[model samples]
Target: MTATHTYDVAVSWIGDRGTGTSGYRAYDRAHDVDAPGRPTIAGSADPAFRGDPARWNPEQLLVASVSQCHLLWYLHLCSAAGVVVTAYADAAVGTMVETADGGGHFTEVLLRPRVTVSEPGMVAAAVALHAAAHEKCFIANSVNFPVRHAPTVTAGA
Candidate 1:
């Protein structure tokens, strides 16, 4: 499988240089995201990095990939089961820790998907569908980390 993205950097303004004083702009094979004062991960000295707490982080991206996969699969499953789902939303989170090898690597990630469904008596079906989705999720199947589904359901009015 293959994927691609691109980025560029014209200029930036940032001061001070320390061990944890650097920032990154997601880039492609062609360009880079300026430097220092430019947009970057949170916890950086730059004010721009501090905004949008809900923005997807690297780990969060992993979680979202799985959550979205499950959601899509669930939709298909519901349709097959004659259930009409109006909307689905998930508040997913991923956890990262230093690898046991001592490098700055994530050892594991947990995906928590809180899904909302429409119609009565669909909660149980949604839960079962989520399980099936996890089994068939391409990302979950490819990753070695544990992907768990903690689902919460509510009936629509």
Candidate 2:
């Protein structure tokens, strides 16, 4: 049997410069994302869209969600499979293409995870688990674009 889960977030626009969007350039593309019992996440559009470069953007957050989901699942699988992970890091990249009409969609996301394991003998299994983890990632499975994995494993010192 399948179980269902629900998630909620509240996004409030804080970009109004008093005039309330009289023109495209009149307002800042800034907002805040809030969830119960969690810290508020400051968000904005990508800098290319006249948003603040210092604040987190929706595209960056989406990519980060995908990466974070995979990492969590990968760690859980590693623990269950007896693969001791000493360190884990990922440089994930996503590509989005904009249409002529000013709309865009992500084409793909590449997860480059560099993992350090407790033993050299566990390298193969550690690398192999990334595919399984990707298969199990809820964010990756839900996305319309492809989510590819390029994992590297090394023995820890």
Candidate 3:
């Protein structure tokens, strides 16, 4: 059965600093991302846009969202395919190019997943499943840019 999924998040800007938007540099881009039962995420614009360096930015979150999607789907597929996973880690990267108008779009996102399986024989199957996971990832499919994976599997003792 096909089912629709939905998510809700509340973003409240808290950078008023007394005088709100008095000038370009007068207000900060600080904000908080919240959801029921979840801790607040301190968020801001990219540092290039005069945002706080300590806070999470939209670009980083976008990359993380797609990376998380791939990780979850890959684990499920591996389990179903009888490849026992012992460890999984990913260092996902995204590239975006800005236009003359100060707007930009993500050109692509690359997922580098390092996985360890219980048996040496499971390496090939584990590597192959990354393609299936990418194809099924909802976040990856929603983006206009391509989401690709370069997965490496190792046997863990």
Candidate 4:
């Protein structure tokens, strides 16, 4: 049997400075995320001395979401298959392009996963599990952007 879960992020526009520093808040189903004076966003400071904080940016979030999804599924699959995963990390990236509506949206995301396996021969199993995780990842399957996984695994380290 297949199982499913759901979540939501609600954002509200507090105000705007016309150029930037526009205020906004992201709320989970529970409540708004607490942060500093201004809601955290990626590229907060530009070279010209403007807010451009990239950590909280949508592009970053897209990459992070893909990374998280793959990691979650990897652990789940490994547990179910009796494979012990020692550690997992990913450097993910996303590309944004102008949409037909003259607004930019993330079009592609890449998940570069570096995974560690607890035993030899399990690397192969872990590699195979990467593909399975990609197939089963809910976020990857749910989003319109192209989500790709590039995995590298090491055994007994």
Candidate of highest lDDT: 2
Q: Comparing candidate 2 with candidate 4, which one achieves the higher lDDT? A: 2
Candidate 1 on 33-141: residue-level lDDT in tens? 2444766533222123342343333455567677788778878888899767776777766655655685444455555556566777787887778788888787788
Misplaced by over 4 Å in model 1 are 1-57, 100-108
Q: TM-score each candidate.
A: 0.59, 0.98, 0.97, 0.71
lDDT of 2 by residue, 1-157 (tens): 9999988999999999999999999999999999999999999999999999989999999999999999999999999999999999999999999999999999999999999999999999999999999999999999999999999999998
lDDT of model 1 at residue 154?
Answer: 69
Candidate 3 local distance difference test against the native: 0.94
- What residue pairs clash in candidate 2, if any at all? none
* lDDT digits (tens) for residues 12-78 of candidate 3: 9999988899999999999999999999999999999999999999999999999999999999999
lDDT of 3 at 61: 98
Rank ordering of all candidates by lDDT, starting from the highest: 2, 3, 4, 1
What candidate 4 gets wrong by more than 4 Å, as runs, is: 1-8, 15-51, 99-101
Judged by whole-model lDDT over C-alpha atoms, candidate 4 comes out at 0.71
lDDT of 4 by residue, 14-48 (tens): 32445443333321111123344556332332222
Candidate 4 weakest lDDT stretch, 10 residues: 24-33
Off by over 4 Å in 2: none
